[model samples]
Target: MISTGEEVLHGDITDTNAAWLSRLFFEQGYALSRRTTVGDQLDGLAREIEHCSLTADIVVVNGGLGPTSDDLTAQAAAMAANTGLELSEHWVAEMEAKYARMGREMPETNLKQALLPQGAEILDNPVGTACGFVMRINRAIVLFTPGVPSEFKIMVQDQVLPYLKALFPSVVSQVCQRLYTFGLSESGISQTLSSLVVPEGVVIGYRSALPFIEVKVFAPQNCPNVSAFYRTIIEMLGDNVVGIGQPMLSEISGLLQENAMTVSVIEEFTGGALVNELHRDEACASLLKDGRFARDFAKTDKDLASLAEAHRRETNADVVLVVGGKRHEAVSVALAGKGAVWVQQVASKRQYSQSSYRTVIATLALDMLRRYLCGMPVFGHYESLSSLSSFSNERRTG
Candidate 1:
């Protein structure tokens, strides 16, 4: 959950926080289902809390926990639950003493932060002043958090998430692995996954665009053969599984860096997404060839190939990725003596999807990009060969 306090509302903050939190939940194996944002209104905040408390096993509410008048999340949660709130005598004394130690009288309104519902627990904060709260309602656990990211992250990691997981101890350890593939459709992934009854707890999801399939397993934690089973799956899937654990754009770029190699970017339609992925890591920065934004290509009457060639020579970069309009393949024009041939097929049919189109596409591109860089003749597309060797004579052409 994210919120916009009446005074502190900002657009970009919510977008970044949501992505970060979702990644954290994925890492922690939480089945997060809903995300919501509401302007700072105590009534609105209360209603949302009520709704979330009804269905979710654990609801994480972010924002509006400051000492200001407009920061009303704590009070709103009490109202939403039809509970009363009064200052916690112990906390008020604790806070006032802390303020006095700093040689300042504690603002009276700071007492509002100590107010809590009858059954709620106060989450400790080591960094900031705002302390989050937690309580159970309608058989669901609700964890309220400060909107300020640094405070919220600390409280959640140090306290809230651990507490929430304790309530629902996973009977089956949820094990998941992402397998990326290029030159394959969602249907193709389905066909491949359907025949494998390898384990009862394993379920497969086909993500198109980032072009990979994910294998999720809810195997028993005590299962004796889990290691062998994990190895078997990895081996059976072969080189299609690019990198493991966390999805990494840096992994491919890091491998290139270790080999003292470089890569470049040419933007056509993907805006700066591809470029950001390429230049995200310092290791990837080694692969930085000169880049051309879409504006550079369309606004100026520059010779595209010659311009690319000059950048290749100037930066000594090998791989050049060209992003064009959708459904068109992204071609890599490897410099005569530079990087491997990396490619992509991006489509613009996601305007009507019920799933994550960006994840599908981005994951797929990185998977193929990694494999090609690793010297695998990817089976789904062409004959297997050393990626570096195949590009030995590949001139500054796609």
Candidate 2:
């Protein structure tokens, strides 16, 4: 991989494209062997490409394909392939037509974007003028794409993915499944899976995606034992498993919307992150009302419970979620449904970051509320702080 930009190297900009590409390839069961970054320097860029070509079967080059003086990926690619840059009239005309539709003439600087390495095939860009190119160098295939995220994403999804799939059908034919988990720490999860023996030819890897730890398995598409492999993982993860794909904050929000339930938040420890996460979905937005943040709160458990009940009654919400704790103490989360309340706490020492920790707290609170609405046990009796008591006559079940 070739990611070029002085801004990226200098930390003025983040290289999000690399992370996005990693997940994209992983989904197709192709693991990236290596990734290299270089500035707009011609010699360095050429050196990295040459090295990558020798090391991996495919090299993906992103960025530095603009109309500016610093845009040097095309020229660098030509140097690495030991060929000269040549202008393509077809691309020039394509750019001209694209600009014509916008009621403007093509600029001369954009002609640099039309230049491609000798014998390279144009990877058409419908969204932007910086059309990408693909070429073979030694034993590797190199693809150069635009730096703009929108252009890069479209090119990858529409052109690059299909091309790679066709060129390496066997690689793309492999089956991969990802299981997202929340609540469990990475070490805890590792310990849980450490005892299980995985079958040969099936690869299992764990990655931390913030509040969720993604358990990914790659097996041949024709493997009949894949179901058993996933079942073992599910058994180990248990209720901590959120879903099979990437876990989004909108999921919990969508659940509330589907249930036609309104929620109110009384946050003391999570700052406003819980509310912010809920607002990500518009349908979820309607399900949320009376969201408030308290910088300081009562230290006693009784006062906190009274405050949560009062907040729920004032808003007349179907569910009320509360999060509270001191910085050095255990983080506590409470959920109120109708007249019953459930609470759970975890040590703050195990948390990694302030933001991520607060996010986990919020996630736990929401998950509890979700289960409560579904008539599932919010938490085990041992984890519950308050006794099985409610203003309503509904008896708590284990």
Candidate 3:
């Protein structure tokens, strides 16, 4: 196990380098058993270093090796090992002379870095003012590097981790792919591919919203046929695959922008999720004219007629959409819904009627309006609206 510890103070430096180092160890198959953070307190530092060094095969400590008084890593390490810090005869001399060679006297505090544990060997730092080192504690290697990210990265890349890897056993290479999909829930996506062959090593998982989904796979690094496994899964899921790294909604928004299409929506549960997604591209705002919004469950027959009439008169909206609700209230927690869209041309046709439920009446009015902007057929209550142009309704009766 490789353990890392750091001490953070408010305004000195950020510790992202430590986190990146931990990721490197994890990718290399080293068990990162523990990670801890401590303030610049010697007792806390001593306890953390001692505990980590004893528990892990290697304890990588970063930070506090500075000229400042708050930099107590070296002192804490010595204290943890119960060893006294003794100044290096050669190291102390060289650092002082090097600074003098640069036409400046080295700060007296910097002389502190010259100290060495009785059995510890200095790990040369070629890039910065601080020097890192490594030592053994109860059969574990404790590597210490600088706190500054640039210096720390350079030191670890060159000295620290390589030494730790040398002392540690080699692990198998592992690889996994995260596949993203659109238009299905986790269960729905899983069920769609239920008959598909995903291979034994490749697994699938789903995250759902009405128009989007994400499926990811994890497998052993360097697992042979991993590419084939990925390819097969991608083929099985086909267009549902929304590319990688980006989620489905993001991809769809990209597609909408690329195709030069505009999308307007009717606000309901999703509360602007779709409109917000569609307008992710700042350029898309130019294409989107306006959204017709009537967000509530409080519509009677008379209410629906008035709302639709008011909607048609106000926004001249080309397309209307309804989406979103809190998770758990629906089939899947994020399983937001999209209802029919109404176009201004249809509202003027003068044949749309109202329903007892104001929401239904509003959607019906929007569906009549939809035929001009979107040709997707039918808006049934139990049916899910997972895609922009997916549902086909031959039956016009609402």
Candidate 4:
């Protein structure tokens, strides 16, 4: 694949299209031999396309398909294919009709979009004037697409993917599942699962996305027992497993909606990050009622319990969650509802930036609330279980 853009090369814009296409192709069992990104210069673009075409069975070139002067992908495609450019009358008429439907005359510069490599097939772009084209170079089939994300995505989904599937009938179907976990380092999680027996036709991989580790399980479409591997990892990882394919806050939102419960937020050290996360979830508009920011509070369990109860009573919510403690020392979470209160305080395992620390505190508070609501075991150094108990909140050294 060849990505052509000066913005990407100069760091003016991120190359998200390359990442998206890579994942899309990989999930469909396509072997991406190499990905090459080039500037808008015609020489570099043509050179990369020519080289990739000779080395790989399939080549996809994105960007440089605009109507601007720097748009040279069409010409470069012809150069790579060892042919001359030909004006596609069908595309020209289509562009004219499209502009007429929009009550505007077709720009003369847009006529450049109708040019294609000789004997190339036009890939229709329904959303834009820049047309995509497919042609063969050496042993590889090269596809050229526009740089605009909307147009590029539409062309790939509507035309390029279908063509590749039809052209390569032997490509197998693969299913990729992601399981998210927290409170465990990526290396630790990997070591924990290192001894497990991997099933046939299944491939497991791990990636760390800060505060969470994702385990991606890839299996053949016909494999019915893929879920068993996921369950085994969950059991082995224990409480570290948050949920599958979602963040911790999202999982908490699902649980709240499923159990028909509402919650109020009271955070101290985490700033309003927790409240912001709750508001981010659409269902939280109904589930989250009142959020309070307690900048200063006594470090006693009695004070935390009182704060939680007062927040619950003021907001009339089924549950109230609290986050407190000194920065860089430790954080405490308290869940009060259903005639009980549970408080757990955990220290920072590693030094993190203030933003990351706030995120960790927010997720920890949400996980605590989830466990309390679901009757799952809560992980903490100190645990207090009582119908009406007061918490003595203090950071303890291990």
Most TM-score-accurate candidate: 4
In order of listing, the candidates' clash counts read 9, 0, 16, 2
Cα lDDT tens digits, model 4, 162-181, are 99999998898688888888
Which regions of candidate 3 fall more than 4 Å away from where they truly are? 1-14, 89-104, 176-221, 236-398
Top lDDT: which candidate number? 4
Residue pairs with colliding backbones in model 2 are none
Order the candidates by lDDT, highest first.
Answer: 4, 2, 1, 3
User: For model 1, how does the per-residue alpha-carbon lDDT over 1-398 read when each residue is reduced to its tens digit?
Assistant: 64546543556444555656775675566757888787788888889888888877778888777888888888888887888886777777777777888899998888777887777888887666677788887867888888777787788788977786786667233555554544445565456656656655444444544344455444444555555666666666666656555445656866787777677766655556666666677677656766666643522212434445555667666655544333232222222224323232334333423234433443444554465567654222421111211122233323
* Candidate 2, residue 355: lDDT: 79
- The models' CA-based lDDT, in order, is 0.60, 0.79, 0.55, 0.81
Instruction: Point out where model 2 deviates above 4 Å.
Output: 246-251, 295-299, 325-331, 344-347, 351-354, 380-398
Candidate 3 lowest-lDDT run of ten: 328-337
Off by over 4 Å in 4: 325-328, 380-398
Q: Write the per-residue lDDT of candidate 3 for residues 17-77, one digit (tens) a residue.
A: 6568755665556637777677778898888888787777767887778877777888888
The weakest ten consecutive residues by lDDT in model 4 span 381-390
**Residue pairs clashing, model 1:** 209-360, 209-361, 210-360, 210-361, 210-363, 210-364, 263-287, 318-339, 377-384
